[model samples]
Target chain A: MAAEHADSGFNIFPMDQFVIRPLFGNHGMTWYTPTNQALWMGIAIVAVVLLLVIGTRGRALVPSRTQSIAEVFYGFTYKMIEDINGKAGLKYFPVIMTLFTFVVFANILGLLPYSFTVTSQAAVTVFLALAVFLSVTIIGLVKNGPGFLKVFWISSAPLPLRPILAIIEVISYFVRPVSHSIRLMGNMMAGHAVIMVFAGFAGALGIFAVFPVVAIMAVYGLEVIVAFIQAYVFAILTVIYMNDALHPGGH
Target chain B: MASEQLMAGAGQIGEHAEGMPQLDFANYPNQWFWLVVTLLVLYVVISRIALPRIASVLAERQGAIARDIEQAETLKRQAVEAEEAYKKALADARAEAGRIVAEAKADIQKELDIATEAAEAEIAAKSNESELRIAEIRKGALDSIEAVARDTAGEIVKAIMPVAADQKAIDAAVTAKLKG
Candidate 1:
């Protein structure tokens, strides 16, 4: 198991599990080859279906535990979008729920043993962030026309500082996706790596491995909370960004 | 052989440490494909089923609440109206009772006045009849006394001077005395 990592001092290859390997024998990965990443992604999807869809199939007047959970999750995302975007903003509630559940499921499933952290990977987050950024830009332009530019134009500032502020605003607007993607990916990757580092120490310490083991348990519990928070933060930010699209020009 | 195996392993790790696994382009299409598929599935399921059901339930609850409030308002108004009707009926009944009492008092007062007048006339008629009866009794008593006195005088005369002499004279004397 330590064969993959070169020993500067320790042979703990934390990054090895993140590698994309073919599900079949040692064959080359064609586009169709089901990699570990794809398998986990599918599993996350199935988990979402079972938990949300089938669990709430009863649609009872008085909800069971599973149904209540599904409805609560639904209402949480719905109210979040409504509060940030207003009534007009709630039109896009389905999209927001989809995005939230995607990140939420991806983050949670990735925490399992021998599982790939789909959201911790840059490619996945970048794709989602870019999609948000692009679609927001397009939708704002389409709906508000040239008035969409008014979001960057701060009218409350002194007239002389408007253009300078607009430039800063524009820069910040572009910087959104970079920060958005990096924050989630970085948090996930960092938490998992820290756990791995502890794992490596646990093996090396032998007798006092119990300390690291205990630490791992504590961190793992925290990661479960972090997983939910990151998803929530990502969803809230999406709503806030979408608000700019819905109300392009205001104080 | 072990050294050779170690060299092979080192080479493999070196190839992996060349860059991050995610940055590898070969895995991109497959990940992208599944991402698209899963997102579509989630979107369809959430949009078509779960959210709609919750929304309908919420709307139904809101409607029920509104209906219940409207019903309560209607009942309250009806109760107020019913109380008003009750009060009005009570006042009417009281007024009717007052009229009834007034009619009865008038009728009773008229009957009492008539009875008092009848009783006073009867007492006056009885007093007049009793005064006439006393005068008649006094006259009868005077006649009876006169008759007794005359008879007694005649009886005395017969016994002493023999005969029915001076009957008329005796009666004249008695009558004169009694009259005086």
Candidate 2:
């Protein structure tokens, strides 16, 4: 492992030191772990809770500026849910809002001087993505009963092509969570690593630092915009999934 | 020999590093546990708290707009009624002025007719009295002239003939002169 670490140009990939290695060996265990990512997750949860608890406690009619901003976020999420799922979708507004806020905060927080980005780790993003996937699948099954299989194959095409298309459709459906998780993790990990390398260059080339510094600044600005966009993309996907579960007309 | 083995191992590692990570669901054991917890918490919060508040706020905003429109309609109706009342009052006032002017003109005409009739009666009475007074003056003058002529004739007869101065004869001559 040490030789592998040395072989890499830099130690950018997470290692066992960054994870909480399980005390005992079990049937399922990994050589790699993500302890820093777990810690960041805890921080994200606390921050989200603190913001929500304080923001919603008073429930004022004529909102203060702070309260009004909170209201706007809540309103935006509600409208998104309504547009995607109609009135029935309103029930999922809080989850979508929380997910959006947490992911965005996690992304932006990683841009801070000494902060670790939890979302950059595959495990963290995979966990969130899988949860959405399972819930949507379960909702579809519960709502449609045996008819849920029609979402994949039986409802669309002729009988001869149904089996062939069903297999492909099923594989794609299973791949949704993997793609969703990897997309976010890969983006965050790549962006952070690039910024780190640029900052390192600025540190190394002390006298002629202007180019590196400007590059870092530009990357930072782009990261901030990406942070917001990733959150929106995640939330919008969740709404689309909910829509699929509710009304499976290939939307 | 050890140096050669190490170099070969390094080459193999470099080659393996380029390949993507294997799909190892077993290695990622905590995935299921975290997924369950996150989903449960999110579902509970969404169903219980967040959605209801948002819906109620939207409903309230819609209600307020409807109420404002209703109030505006009522106010417009009241304004129209007030305008109609003002126009009606102005029309009544104009009609009253016209009636009063016509009545005054009729009263002045009646008074002028009565005054003209009274002046004409007074002038007719004064003219009749003047005519009666003139007739009396003329009769008196005639009587005085007749008496003077008779006295002059009697004096002339007495101077001419003493015998003729008898009372019966002088009386007969005077009577004849007066007659002629």
Candidate 3:
């Protein structure tokens, strides 16, 4: 028992779980190294394939269970995009669906013991957010030309305050990806860390360890819900941002 | 021991900051590459294969249901038309039956009227023949009585005066007496 250590081994390395390491022999990490992140991501990809691709192979009018699960995800993503962005935004449906399924699968798979959470990393989330941001900006530019700048102009505001509001709008516009990415990463990382911290208490508590174990169970359940919600939030935010790109003059 | 070595390795990797591995910038490229590859695969599977297949299945189902409903409606209309034809045939048959029955009744009535008239005429002729035969029988009976009376009177006169009576006078007396 690690509890035999001096001062009752209270070594609770919550962040250690987030540490990236090579999946095979520990070698220096390069750009193309196969890491645990890649393994779990691969697993997430397999999950998506099993659910969306092979699951719907039946193509039944009356769907089977796995097919229904795939349809639920599809319907949920479709409704989210259509509700926020309307018909024009459906062109970007694939991107949003990918984002949703990736985040959801990654987050949920992270809940497994000893499994690495891919979405918890700032690098991955930041890239996703930046992808949405850059694409939406380019789409706005291409679609609206100079008219896309009107998103920040706030024509409804009084003339004198319009410039200040525009400045704020522009800053917030750039800040969107930062908030978007951090929100998902922070939620995943924080929940998992909290569960780890709680599990760490079981070592020293002995008989009272039941409390921490129970708390871990409770937090694990909450994390499961948080995992789905964070993905939904990410996908919906992407749709909303895309709506701004599609109809920049509306805001 | 593994935890310690893992911590040591992690620590060695980030000599300056052991706080959060997420901030470690060296691993960013590895994460980015795999993520992009995975997303590309998912996007291809979803947009290219899954979504369109589901949409077509749903559309096919919709079309099938519409076609079934239309077929049912057509069948129902045909049934209605058949029923109408049946009813019209029944009504026409009933009317034809009624016409036949009326014609038969008229024919029977004319036959009955002709029979009744022939019976009445035969009865009238039979009654006239019977009256003529009764008048002839009465005349024969009157002649027989007159002859008998004349013979009896002549027999009485011969017994009293031995005189013979005339037949013509007897007959004239008898006829005058019968008339009175």
Instruction: Score each candidate by Cα lDDT.
Output: 0.83, 0.67, 0.86
TM-score of candidate 3 chain B vs. the reference? 0.62
Question: Candidate 1 chain A — worst ten consecutive residues by lDDT sum?
Answer: A1-10
Range of the 10 consecutive residues with the lowest summed lDDT in candidate 3 chain B: B9-18
After TM-score superposition, the amount by which residue A100's alpha carbon in candidate 3 deviates from its true location, in angstroms, is 1.8
Q: What is the Cα-based lDDT of residue B107 in candidate 2?
A: 93
Model 1 bad stretches (over 4 Å): A1-13, A203-210, B1-26, B68-110, B113-180
* Poorest 10 consecutive residues by lDDT, candidate 2 chain B: B14-23
Q: Which residue runs does candidate 3 get wrong by more than 4 Å?
A: A1-9, A154-165, B1-18, B90-180
lDDT of 2 by residue, B22-99 (tens): 122233455345434544564455446644554465466667778989999999999999999999999999999999
List where candidate 2 sits over 4 angstroms from the true fold. Answer: A1-35, A153-168, B1-84, B87-180
lDDT tens string, model 1, B30-95?
667767777898899889986887777666767878999999999999999999999999999999
Which consecutive 10 residues in model 3 chain A have the weakest lDDT in total? A1-10
Over A1-251, each residue of candidate 2 has an lDDT whose tens digit, in order, gives 55674465444332221222233432223333333344555566656554444555555555556556656777778788998899988766677776777787688777787676766667667878887899999998998887777778756577899899889888988999988888887777667767766765666576876897899899889988888788788888888887878877553
Docking class of 3: acceptable
Candidate 3 has an lDDT of 0.86
lDDT of 3 at A223: 96
Q: Provide per-model DockQ scores.
A: 0.25, 0.10, 0.31
- Rank by DockQ (best first): 3, 1, 2
The clash number for model 2 is 2
* lDDT of prediction 1: 0.83
